[model samples]
Target: MERISTCLKFYLLEAGNDGSIEHVDKALIANLMTLFFAGRDTSGALLTWFFWLISKNPVVENKIIDEIRQNLAENASPKHIFSNVQELGKLVYLHSALSEALRLFPTGPFLLRVPNQKDVLPSGHKVDQKTKIMLCSYAMGRNAEIWGEDCLEFKPERWLSDKGGIKHVASNNFLAFSSGPWTCPGKELAFIRMKAVAATMIHNFHVCILDGQNIVPSISAILTMEHGLKATISSRWV
Candidate 1:
């Protein structure tokens, strides 16, 4: 794949400006750099964490497999594309699992925002225009005060209501893809990619964690698996 910045630069140069275009090179460069980093960096870590979670939680993986089988039915042909996002959305359990995974290990880990004017937060914390605030999404998601005593548990079902639609998590409760207009535009695409990769893997193999592997979470702007997720994949046919 061509380097993102190089491709972006080519496009920008192609769209010549005869005093009409704004000096958007710097902005485009910044945004492209963010996308490159977010796309490659967060995605890998998330998948690693996801497999690790599934390894220790066989029941979850099994449910995912069952969902895939039921959805595809007799057409177990691996080459077929599951083209409908709406149909994919019917895999409610998988959606919950992914959402729960992201909640526990938010890709961005923390959100930093500077106050434009003096204001007080809901928690009664006062801030001025210059004050920089860092909201620890990783920590907040796991906080008992925020998510209840069982916050640390890997329970995908928690994200579903009895009626079986998207549950209404508090606005501040889970901000993995974030909220409002600032929310990730690629959120749906990310879910599609994640679901496709996961469904493919589950259909092809049974995954188990390597014995005695120590996996740890590291926070450095992004939530990453410090030791990495080491697992053994045995082909399903075996």
Candidate 2:
């Protein structure tokens, strides 16, 4: 609250310099509300799908556990868990797995945009200011043309490069976090939070999707589980 208050004060001062405080508080409050919802809801949705994916693919889960164990051993941390950003950065496989999950089930499955003028997209689609453009990232992620034959498969290895580092793809192809100047400002922070939660959970517990449960994406503005994930979790240490 202090930080927000400080930022509000700064904005007010800047606006005061321009000789107008009209509606500034309301505008700031609206922006703060938008930021809070965007960050919280989207990250929550991402984690929901992430854990569901891991539950279905135990091999991938095991691989993530192995990576975490290897990194912890090399760091020789008495805590047996990632304690800092530097340590969290070493979980490359975990990062890839999360990215893979994002690719398949982007929080905002469709991106809506309005063009300022008439234009032709690279795909030769013509658009004008009146047209409502909806980019379906979920479908794009599964398209064979964009992601190859195994696009539908949950394969985290695809995000790894030949040198064992995370592979970079054009933002246009991976629209989970959006693209261009209007891209998400909290993208990096979101990744850090995700890595921390995913790593910590996997390191300490084994998650299994309850048998015979049908898991499907919800029909909504956000990608959430249609039927919330049912899973059995057990301690990995004991």
Candidate 3:
């Protein structure tokens, strides 16, 4: 309530400058709707894919559980587990696993762009202003040239540096959150949310993907499982 009231006040103040409270209100509403949908849907999809990937790779799941337990300690209170970004930041392996999942199954799998002017791509392919180009992030992520021979494998270690820290990749090559000025504003929020939820879940539950379930990406604006993930989750906590 306090945050909403504060936002309303700011919107009204801005409206005072242009004498357009109605327009400002509409814009504010639209912005709120976009934030809610984008934040929830994309993060939900990412979590789904992340869990599926981890299920298929028990080593990765065990590593994540070990990391989370080590960071929070075995007797840490449930209320305080991964309660802050600082603590969550220390889960480097968890972060790497999330990154690997995003690499394979990006929520926004395709991006469309129209060049403002005639241009030549690195491939020497000519494109003009009228050309509409669709860049497939899913295919790009699986490309051998970009991700090497084992690109199709779910390997979180690939994102870890020799020193065991999260290795930064160029945005052009890793477009899970999009790139440039138009990048998703909630990118950081999404990571924080995912980490908190993932850590808490993994710390308390043993998630198993039901055997023989055929999972594939659905045809939608967001990358979702075609049949959804069929998983049996059991409590890990005493």
Candidate 4:
């Protein structure tokens, strides 16, 4: 709550809460609650899945570690601080991996809402004024019709273009942060934190998944590991 209040105060300062802000009391509470619950859960779940995926694939894991090491070599004090945002932003492979992971296991597997007015989605789905809708981001991500038959495969290279640049991954297919006015504001922050944690952990240790452990998704609005992901970590340098 303290963290939420602190962030809200910063927001209020940035927006300059004028007399017109009177009607925002309930809205503020709702938004704060949404952030409080959504922020931590989504990030935790993402990192869990990321680690699990990397553990299963040593080639990918080595690639991430190599990137981190390369970045560290360029930094004067890599353990203390991130030297530059430019370098962080250039983590194209990491970004692609994260995108792939989000596609496979979106935090909010499904989104629910009712249309405020009659509308037609790009997918040609028509909704009347009071129609309730369930947009399955999870299903949309793995749909062979949209992403090809290998949609279920974890391939980060799909997010890169032939020019070796970060490709414009479509938001319609990947709605982890959602879309439109109700999208998560902390999307960038969450991605940065997730990538940073994954890079740091992979660079420092080699994670080996314990044998025969059934790691499944939990039943919740926010995606969580059904069983806590258990893995053994060995020092990478060794």
Model 3, 117-224: lDDT tens digits are 999999998999989988888998999999999999999999999998989898889888777765666666677789999998888787888888888899987999
lDDT of 3 at 223: 95
The lDDT-based order of candidates, best leading, equals 3, 2, 1, 4
Q: Which is the leading candidate under TM-score?
A: 3
Clashes of each: 0, 0, 0, 0
What is the full ranking by TM-score, best candidate first?
3, 2, 4, 1
Candidate 4 overall lDDT versus native = 0.75
The candidate with the higher lDDT, 2 or 4, is 2
Across 34-71, the per-residue lDDT of candidate 4 in tens digits comes to 76566787888888898788677778777776776666
Quote each prediction's TM-score. Answer: 0.80, 0.82, 0.84, 0.80
In model 4, how large is the Cα lDDT of residue 160?
Answer: 84
* Per-residue C-alpha lDDT of model 1 across residues 1-238, encoded as one tens digit per residue: 1343455666577544543355566555666666645666777778888888877788998898888878874645765456567667778888888888988888889888888899999889999988998878888889999778999999898888999876878656777776665666556667776776777777777777888877788858778987777777888765
Candidate 2 structure quality by residue, lDDT tens digits, 139-226: 9999999999999999999999999999999998999878987677567667877898888888887777778777788899989888
Candidate 2's clash total is: 0
* lDDT for each candidate structure: 0.76, 0.83, 0.84, 0.75
Better of 2 and 3 by lDDT: 3
TM-score for predicted model 1 compared with the true structure: 0.80
